[model samples]
Target: MSKYWNEEIECMSREDMKKLQSERLVTQVKHVYENVPYYKKLMDEKGVTPDDINGIEDLHKLPFLTKADLREAYPYGLLAKPLSDCVRIQSTSGTTGKRVVAFYTQNDIDIWENCCARAIVAAGGTKDDVCQVCYGYGLFTGGPGLNGGSHKVGCLTLPMSSGNTERQIQFMMDLKSTILCCTPSYAAYIGESLKEMGYKPEDNKLKAGIFGAEPWTEEMRREIEKSLGIKAYDIYGLTETSGPGVSFECEEQTGMHINEDHFIAEIIDPKTGEVLPEGSKGELVFTSITKEAFPLLRYRTRDICVLTREKCSCGRTLVKMSKPMGRSDDMMIIRGVNVFPSQIETVLIEQGYSPNYLIEVDRVNNTDTLDISVEMNAEQFSDTIKDIQKKEAELVAAIKTMLGINPKVHLVSPKSIARSEGKAVRVIDKRKLH
Candidate 1:
């Protein structure tokens, strides 16, 4: 565990990468066999042992860990280290059952900082810049992870963990923070707050923003950048995969590059659990080959995405995954038609409407009905209410062509919708029983 942290592993060659992963994988399996009862029982049931997982090629033989497995184990059941050795813990919001808590040793914290540092650097962040972390800190993974990474990057880090948009803007002005990190919804909310406070974007002197923890479209990115007058970059990760620095978008803005050396990423079919080749859309699976405190094997992330092996001009050897559209659980089924809220955002933005929209689904007379509410910018509000009604009608027709279903569309004033600081709750499916 003391030997888990490595900072100078950035320039590892392909062969070096294989050797490092192979060595760490075996060592981790042995550690799990000795210290973790859950993994040991799983191995015994499969009639396999640490000796069988000798290298990366033998990964297929090990039992895959999933959300269900974590749930069955509950809290502290998968720790391969002693409680005295563990320093920190982070849990997923679960929302369905007991939270999935991940234990971390000091070594785990150091490696997380290294990964976050890579993400910051990829987004053109430098030591000269001041980092303002806006993601919520305790229990959630985004804030503290980026805070540590920004500190390690030799920058003046502001641990302003989310909320209080007005105060966040004030600190941004007073401290002159150049780098901002938070969820996309928060960024958009802060943008609206800035406008409400009559603050000019040019006055804050922010240069770049690293946004993650929720899925967002490029249209939303453009809106955030335009509102804040800064370059907005995407950082992708989950608590199951070491949080915010698992993948990151470079200056090219093409896609997020997965840090393949620390964690091996694969896209597999959600239903069949069969690995799909590069460029095929599937669920993202991660194998924490280098983790010590909680090294998850073939962990199903349930994120639908595609990967590309083609080398990018950024010079990073990591593989790139497309921005996730939606989670498999988050997918909507309406009258035998599959729909994603992202598709609605795409249509709204393409038609020159604000990206802020909400979907409401209800069952009446045994038929599901969907209603969408979109906020109309002040620029679109002119003359009278009739004009707004006419525009709303046009948008309703536009959505019909897009979604192939006529969804009741309503237009509301700008800033009238509920602002989300972290994750946005867009859909209200009354038909789905809790």
Candidate 2:
């Protein structure tokens, strides 16, 4: 079996990759500057024109775009192609604000699917495999992206858009699904559900899982891998960047390889917005070079991570990005300290608690308070309040040691926390910060 879906491009030399990126980026910039008035305005303000950007080296000259810019543009402000040319529109969950609607031309869709197919292939997917896609469909990009890619790979795709866990498992067993795609949290939930349904990790035919759409910890990754008896690979993307195929993990299991031919990845100092050197952990930024309908240049992803050009065992020369540590916007400041949900999650998983947990932040008596409600596995659940308190105290200490800020820990019953087939709600901040 071929190890790569597009070996020619995936393993292209750095010089060739940069040349391709430069060419596409030049054309894309002209297209956006000519068609998208909002971005043109941004560029004009920055005194940058298409003539200024010759190649990837000049990418730093482009102005940055943020979620705020997308919201300001709303439905069609940043569209480069006409609605007639756009074949589809995939959107964000709108949980943060106005849903970011991304237009896709048929060519755009083809390239996006090709990117996804690369991800599936990296996860060891082949035409003979049954690829089950459970990401939420409709406006959300997860379902459609993987679904298209599965078809491209000639896998018998199960477009079982997220939810209905029982039906998902039934299909998994009946059809003998070889690859599963969904959010990491949902994958964990499915793992927990399989155990409850009297199925061992190896009972099903699943050999691999491609999980993304939400931030997850390494500990959670190992847990899911053990529960499903499959190598759980991480895929990363946003609706703004045409969904979960912008980058994907390979057998190396180190970091996701960004599809650099389609998108240029950069790390920037979050506060100053200066592009950081390679290996520096900072805010992640992307510039879509080939996207026709809605190409975003220098779009700030708010994700904190590093990028490395280090050669890989997989032989793909594409740049690899560390799994995002946390989003700049998602970072919580409590008691004059910065805390990320992933840090808390790491502590929970290490402490042998269920990955399903809730973090609630609030202010009382003019002081910020942090409380974490962690679900206890069946074996750990006890009727004794003192035992529970002791466990909670231990967890508090562990978390404090990790985060440097003490958090009130509440151990709750297994299955008490609401299960989500979509992105799991991890934090609920009640503080009013204007």
TM-scores for every predicted model: 0.92, 0.98
- Over 222-256, each residue of candidate 2 has an lDDT whose tens digit, in order, gives 99999999999999999898998999999999999
In model 1, state the lDDT of residue 126: 77
Give me the candidate number with maximum TM-score. 2
Candidate 2: residue 238 lDDT (0-100): 91
Tell me, what's the RMSD of every candidate?
3.4, 1.0
- For all candidates, what are the clash counts? 0, 0
Q: State model 2's lDDT.
A: 0.94
408: Cα error in model 2, Å: 0.2
Q: Could you tell me the C-alpha RMSD of candidate 2 in Å?
A: 1.0
Can you tell me which runs of candidate 2 are displaced by over 4 Å?
Answer: 382-384
Tens-place lDDT digits, model 1, residues 1-434: 11112333543566777787888889878888898899888889998898888787787677777899998887778877778988999988575577888888888888888888888887767788899999999989999899999988877999999888888999998989899999988998887678778877786789889999887889989988988989999998888767788888877788887777778887888888887877999999888866778878788888889998677676665678999987755677776677788888877887788778899988788787889999888798888979877888888888888778888898888767788877888788888545
